[model samples]
Target: MHDHRRLGRELHLFDTDPLMGAGLPYWLPDGAVVRHVLEEYVREVERAAGYRHVYSPVLGKRELYEISGHWDHYSDDMFPPMRLGGGEGEEVVLRPSLCPHHALIYRSRSHSYRELPFRIAELGGMYRSELSGVLGGLTRVRSIQLNDAHIFCTPEQAVAEARAALGLIRRAYDDLGIRAARYRLSLPGGGSEKYVPDPELWRRATALLEEVLDGIAYESVEGEAAFYGPKIDIQITDPAGRESTLSTVQIDFHQPERFDLHYIGPDGGKHRPVMVHRSIIGSVERAVAHLIEAHGGAFPVWLAPVQLVVLPVGDAQEERAHDLVRRAEARGIRAELSGPGHGTLGARVRAARLVPYQAVIGEREADAGCAAVRLRDGRRPGAVPVGELLERVGARAGDRGAELWAAA
Candidate 1:
């Protein structure tokens, strides 16, 4: 397997500058393209799944986390709080997770039991005080953007919401080419102080989680759950056989109680709502890193930064090259022109292995109003009409086609 860090640098995906400190990466244009496409796809999926996306601030008062218990339990992983207005204002910390923020949104509004299963989603950027020793490319970083969401539902709808979240996770895994993953039912250990102090609550939450996991194949692992509640962690095996948690569907019984999140029930009484925290591609950066290694930096056409490069055979075709690139862009394709002095046409084409397709524009092809299309997979479908090229490429990208050549 290719090392993602090395490939990331070589392909201009992302880099870390010394001035910016460690564990924080700057996404280059190419990397940003992948991230943008992934985010768009995720938003579409969540929208269809009845999730309403929202934006939240990066920093919140210390009390915000105190209520969520992160200030007490996970402060070591969080950045130190900052005092605003000469130490008179509230102490604020960079938000570590969106759960508390989403909870606050739910609490800010009045809802009936009919709105119980309301889901809020966000691609929130977060900060963590990760040790420099553990920092690696995009996989492990201090600054991360998470595809996070919280579902506030009545007790009766909690399991259904959890199951629906699993379906989303599975769909994402399948779409992204992630395969053969196992589910781990993470629960609190017996008498562990890391977990909440309610035994009955833990039992009831665990049983609900079991009901969801029992419907599917999973292994129960004690002590692997979050401090707040039980969860199901999706463990994915990379190409190198290394397993890592790509996503999670967690049920939080403690936080709702702590934050007093509630809705009016059929009995006209306020009751605590259950919060289900889940993420399909937990961290956007980590997901990109994983996919880079999996595909050796040759991202799918839809996710590729420069899907097609126009290489002019000579100065005679330079204008035509630029023109072709313009036309491709007008058609909503990411295309660029390669100038002379870099290398021969063949050499430039070969150098662009990371790009999905290369179109050679020369006098013969320009006169014929066609392009010599070459696929990354060593197949050259000679002299295709420009219109046909656009149709094929656009369709593949629009459909999020994964192959270099759909017909191939």
Candidate 2:
């Protein structure tokens, strides 16, 4: 089995230190490049889909979770409150979730019926008080950067918004080459204190999710729902055959009621709006962990940290190789020059096998004003003109295409 934790270390992707604490792995430079690219791709996709990004503080007052019912219903997973003063001081805590702060943002201003579906997205951090025994690599982290979003819409618009969120999730999965194991309609279990004590609210929320999942194949799993409501979870299987949720779309009425969020209807009357929560790629850490295994560290061209590496066959072609690297970088391609100092040309190419593209510059090819192009998949397209080569690679990377080369 291709394990992400092992590959992560072998590839210098991430590392965990005792002082940094368990369940907190820091990304190496190359890993940070991959992460930054993925985050930018997500932001672009969300921006195109009409999601307005926002920033919110990671810490909130202790009473904030109390009002959101998290303190009462889900406090066990939260960190102990940090008292500011010695005697009877105000308390604050690292937020376990971002929805409460988002609710406050929604309530910050008045809204009209025309702005029914006010979508807000954030690539924000949150903390969880996970036990050390449960801590692993990126899959279970104490500090998580979530690709979270919330939509406040009228009751009539809830289902449609949720369906759109699911569509976005599928688009992201396709782009990232993620294959979901299954789709699950997670419902609340019977007589569980972990869940809110409101059958009618659960019923209404479950119905909304069911409608959102209409005609979509999904399994109804009890006790898998969020504390506030039912959700549509997009499940993925790891190399160990362990199934976990990677993406989700949920309908929540509880938070709206708790926050007393409302909008002005066409009749100029105050109307309660439903909150739709969704995560396209879920946590960045878990997503990267799965990707490390999925691609086995051989990422797609657009997502590869080092998209192209230029290898010089001999000292005579060193200048040409450097020029090629410069040109490639100028074209916005992540390229590096591997000269004789690194070793033989063959050895250099082998070392850069994980890179998506390799350009070999030899005396003959340099004289001919072209270079031999090789793909990570071991396809040799022979020697091509230098300008044409960079253009093609840049275009492919820009389009985020799965294929290395465009059609003739």
Which has the greatest TM-score? 2
Question: Model 2 segments beyond 4 Å from truth?
Answer: 85-88
User: What lDDT does candidate 1 reach at residue 339?
Assistant: 68
Cα lDDT of candidate 1 equals 0.88
- For all predicted structures, in order, the TM-scores are 0.96, 0.98
Whole-model lDDT per candidate: 0.88, 0.92
Clashes of 1: 0
- lDDT accuracy of residue 311 in candidate 1: 92
Error of 2 at 290 (Å): 0.9
Q: Tens digit of lDDT per residue, candidate 1, span 89-155?
A: 7799999888999999998989899876989999999999999998988888999999999999988
Give the worst 10-residue stretch by lDDT in candidate 2. 399-408
- How would you encode candidate 2's per-residue C-alpha lDDT over 113-167 as one tens digit per residue? 8987999999999999999999888999999999999999999999999999999
Error of 1 at 363 (Å): 2.0
Candidate 1 lands at a TM-score of: 0.96
Task: List ranges where model 1 is wrong by over 4 Å.
Answer: none
